[model samples]
Target: MQDMKIADLPVHDRAIDITGETCPMTFVRTRLALDSLPDGAVLLVRLKGADPRANVPRAAADQGHDLLDMFDLDDGSAILVIRKAGA
Candidate 1:
């Protein structure tokens, strides 16, 4: 991705709202979507519960994307914004 801080990321180009989606499937779908984005593209992921919150970011990071930000929303779900890396 570009040489920018997580907060410096521009508006998200895409969003994967997996609020009601279950475990492994959560990250699975996330990975699939991320793979489809172009370099430096930003994605906002809306998810619920602890498992997805804990695992998806780590997994995405491990896959070489940047976990720009992650925080809880008022409805008990959370939003994780990541900027895609590489070609």
Candidate 2:
């Protein structure tokens, strides 16, 4: 997989929408997807609720990939853009 350029990142990828899910489940699914990807792959995660938004990054940070960016959509939902680090 290719590392998405910063500008093109927000435009693409098959997103995982984990809305209506809480805390660990959100992180769990994200981790599972990330774990299976090769370095440079990107995962776009849409999560609801504050804890998942806040806590997921902390958990992801520990995994070595930088949480490249996050944006809150107008509908009170958030999108997290994560990129795998180091080949």
Candidate 3:
């Protein structure tokens, strides 16, 4: 899908908060959340720090998921919307 505003993205199927997590663990938790969903499921992940913001989406995409939308909140944390592959 073409890049769209976060507000324009579909409602998420699941959500997770990883603002307290770091690096590999950030993606690990995200991966676990994705694994629990059916293909094409949408997951919203709230994360902090530049590492997770930079890594999680790339990792999810590497694993065949689609990065639907991502945006930073006013509080400085960010959200990542991922769509599981296979739809």
Q: Estimate each model's TM-score.
A: 0.85, 0.80, 0.87
What's the lDDT for all of these models?
A: 0.85, 0.79, 0.88
**Candidate 3 lDDT for residue 5:** 61
Worst 10 residues of 2 by lDDT: 1-10
* lDDT for residue 36 in candidate 1, whole number 0-100: 87
lDDT of 2 by residue, 1-87 (tens): 133444754754446888877878999998888877778887888887879878888899897888888977667777899987775
Those runs of model 3 whose alpha carbons end farther than 4 Å from true positions after fitting are 1-10
Clash count per candidate: 0, 0, 0
Q: Residue 75 deviation, candidate 3, in Å?
A: 0.8
Winner of 1 and 3 under TM-score: 3
Predicted structure 2: clash tally: 0
lDDT score at residue 2, model 2, on the 0-100 scale:
38
The predicted structure with the larger lDDT, 1 or 2, is 1
How do the residues 1-87 of candidate 3 rate in per-residue lDDT, one tens digit apiece?
234465764598988999999899999999999999999989999899989999998899899999988877777888888999999
Question: Using TM-score as the measure, what is the rank order of every candidate, best first?
Answer: 3, 1, 2
What 10-residue stretch in candidate 1 is worst by lDDT? Answer: 1-10
